[model samples]
Target: MSTKTLGIALLGVGPGSEPHLQSLATLADSVDLRWALARSNPDKARAAVPPSTRVTADLQEILADPLVEAVIVATPAYTHLEIAAAALAAGKHTLVEKPLDVTLARAEELVGRATAHGVHLGVVLQHRFRPGAQRLKQLLDSGALGAVQSAVLQVPWWRSQEGYYAKAGRGTLARDGGGVLLTQAIHAIDLFRSLVRVRAVVASQIATTAIHTMETEDFASALLTLGNGAPGVLVATTAMYPGRAEVLELVCRHATATLEGGTLRVQYHDGRSEAVEGEAKSGSGDSIMDFSPDAHIALHRDFFGAVAEGRPPTVTGEEALATHRLIEQIVRQGKERAA
Candidate 1:
């Protein structure tokens, strides 16, 4: 006797196609990929997936397909709300990729709809499962780091000129939401807020200093006063050389902890520091595209488990909405400063 597999419909198969395909393939036993939706390029969708899998431009086709119990919305940022809402309304579970939605209001609507329908809704915040990051979170949870005073996030990720130009909506406010902070650094920022128990973000400021081409900022920094009265700094840029490392360092009363390149380093006030090793996906060239299909797989596994056990997924839509509100506030502050 075996458990029945959940059927899934993939809602986008363009530039960001392979990772989701691989993730589905890895969990094939648990997931039946019923359809691949390509509203933009149906030919590209056909080429991206195996001939055995079905292809359709209509999301309703997937919803009507009795086999599809869930939908993975991999469309562009702007269309996430529209597609995800449809999937949820059709009585299917949903796993939407990061940012949840470009705006706080849309995210809230999605959460409310999912709750009303009694369906599981998850957001892809896979970075939390990284071994080193998980260990650091554990330490902080145990109060081993003591009272966290402040933290800094340095994510100087690099993207090639061609990469930015390749997509019409790569660095635009209309499509991509914002630049590095919203796209790249939100993962780290979300983690920072989670670890610090950031109940209230008192203030935020943003600016575009480095990348002149993009409508949004390539370089920006912000100072935040957390609800618990802890201060923090977030600095991110897509303009850097030789690639850049994503680092998060937390200063506490008893010890200071830093995580970078899969290593967790902690310096205690007693003149002792310890290092715990980990591994992150690295590219052959000097590009900061450290994405892993395994991360997406892990995310799927959790979603399926939650559906079967009737529990909430690790990154629920409601929790992600909180992060979206924070980002909206930051962007509003940035716009004010520019005005």
Candidate 2:
């Protein structure tokens, strides 16, 4: 029996493109980075590809290749559903970047199609892959952490005009999804949901106060009651200057788990705390800052592992639907208050 190579075709070569390439490089022997489909410009795709990789402007050509086993939908927010749907229909495993889709309806469409097609449908919520997060997961599962009680997420980052203008469709309701919470803060929120095991958000109040220029909320806060009956607070603001200082902290009966700067810190009731380290990137200001790439690398490893073992991917489509629903609820509730 030949070891099957998972052929991956990258659909977008935009800002968060490098991480997937790095994952392909890191997992070179396991998965093949066969092709890149840029938007009508194969040159950009060609430039982004490492040697022995094909670059094409035609997504159809990539999809038509029998060797291509999966499609990584790193396209913009709005195009995720369409691209992912196409990939799933093509019988390819689909890994979509975050936000999944702009609205709950589109998200359902993609999630539903993937389910019917019986292909692996995963989202890149990579923060959950950090060693700190893994340790926390183990601790919680082992009952070392008694029960999650409360959580707080603070994502204060800044974005400038230059970063907004860098892309034609950025920060718009149509393209980038919402502001910080939707694009930037969702990572923290998703991780929060995972740590606390939030199944259903009961009743909540949402408020949006800062950043008026953008179509969506730049600053928003919400109070949520998780399915397990834990209460938590989520606050995301892009109005803060000097770029990113993302933090996700959860307080359980046994320990206080905190994640920041790719490091997860846990202070246990037994008087022991450990820190998990992550890779570093040098960047300044809000507009150009993101953790999607690191998340993608982590996501890739898990997806490939699942494929190899014939198991489900970590952040499955159904799981992602809950995250999307949470965001949608917050945004809708915030809008109602604003009205």
Candidate 3:
């Protein structure tokens, strides 16, 4: 392992950026958070970050700093491609928050850009770092669960009308890309895709609640065909009152596994059962900023390690693009049916 400490910069200082800051704070030995670049207000950004960090309103300042070896793009969904492209162009390893980009084309472009620049590019699908999720992946990969016959994923979350949606770009297409499916449920969606390949989908979407006036759907459901020729189901919504923990249930030939509330339960056909506990604080049912920093910290550790070792991070740009492509297909199917 390389002993070199990575000099990291944060591109956004909004609510989404808080997790990055918290994680970096705990990883001081491996990373130096050199600068924070906020386009709107530098003072507020300074206040949000630690005292040791520098604050700036200009992107050029972050790019010009040779000491800044990597950047964490925590900006809006629509801004991911532009910011990540610029960072890669500057020869800085880039770690984007999620979805890679709002669209497949832009995400692909970013992957190409990162390749051309010879820099590490990663996405923050922190759920992959969750203990329960990790164990589930291990079991599936080891064939301990046998052949997966069917799978179901549900993300029924809530965002307060007065607190979350009141923000200017909460659920708008132009800034946020999409509603619950893209923002809230994308984590679960990515986790699902990590475990299985979704070959085909038939989906329906709607804005069924008056919780917040938004341009995109607050609810979506899909029937899917997996790569193994098994059936799958996905349901994502922000309209559920009081919200609930996200769940992913996988039924295999010999065993069944269910992950909910950061806990994993597996029951074998022989009538034996096992339970594994995950992080105490589940990010479900709370504000987006309510997540614990443990997973984010793990993600950053792996990202920095990959950058130093000249290897791809856990969630590469191309890997994240696959989930985006699936999301685009689902949205397209829904639009075609509505038309």
Candidate 4:
């Protein structure tokens, strides 16, 4: 694994690209940093990667390079399909940032293109790669927790009004697609859904809290139905003061599991206990990219391995659609209630 290296390019070098950059930094040996397309800050992008890597402003140049076997599209949500379409059409493996795109339709199209071109497509939903998350997933899959009776997923986070949401197109439908759920809690939503399959949104409420004025909701609360016909609740908000870690609590027949931040603790009814601490950070506060790069690194490794083996990545385009569809359902239900 250490000696196997794949030619990779980073497109849309921006603040959002930091995690991916950090992952590539640790994966230097596993990947050849072929190109960094700055398009905006060429000098900054050049300084961020190794001097051996080429810095370019043109997408065509990166697409034309046969050695660039994979392209990581770290661009804005709306630009995802356009950029990723080119890469996939060129027969290069592509990994796009989360939420897939501004719209689920666009995301579906992007995934369709990858399939049409016979290329690997993955989304940057890194939560399932976290150690704690992995443990919980295994427990549920092995039936060690028995059947899930109930669950609660909460993301009580904070994003300063002046410094965060006020940024250009920060919480707008045109830019980020939606608010906290899409931009911030998507990771948490994806992670929880992977561990506990959420079957439906029973009821929901969405709102733009007094904490900030934005086009999208800064808070959302919903009642959910789990796959086992169990009940669950989802509460996500970026208006909380002095942010804290997100949490997911599950009450299973044999055991109960509590996941907060990067830690997971499970208590079996028989007095046995289990815990797996994760290093992945929770960007629940002001800075969205404040988490550790462990999950990101894992995603990179899995993606590269999947490409080499001609297998679908763990969080493939189709797998990611589950989250996107779930988010859309939450938003639509919430808004309809308001209307």
Candidate 3 lDDT over residue span 1-339, tens digit each: 478888989999988898888899898887888999888878889898889899888888889999999999999889999899999999999999886877678889989999999899999998888888889999999999999999999987887777677778778878878878878788889989998778888565545467667788888888999879999999888888788888999999999999985789999999999888975445555466776888898899899999899889999988888888888888878878778
lDDT of 1 by residue, 82-152 (tens): 89889999999999877777666777888999999889999877767666777888888898889888887
What is the Cα-based TM-score of model 2? 0.91
Q: Estimate TM-scores for all models.
A: 0.90, 0.91, 0.95, 0.98
Candidate 2 C-alpha lDDT tens digits along 270-317: 898787876443122543534435556677878877766778998998
- By summed lDDT, the worst window of 10 consecutive residues in model 2 runs over 281-290
lDDT winner between candidates 2 and 3 = 3
Provide the overall lDDT of each model, using Cα atoms, as 2-decimal numbers.
Answer: 0.77, 0.76, 0.86, 0.90
- In model 1, the clashing pairs are none
TM-score of 4: 0.98
Order of quality (TM-score): 4, 3, 2, 1
Compared with the true structure, the alpha-carbon lDDT of candidate 1 equals: 0.77
Clashes of each: 0, 1, 0, 0
Off by over 4 Å in 2: 1-3, 199-212, 279-284, 287-295
Q: Which scores higher on lDDT, 3 or 4?
A: 4
Task: List the pairs of residues colliding in candidate 2.
Answer: 158-286
Which has the better TM-score: candidate 2, or candidate 3? 3
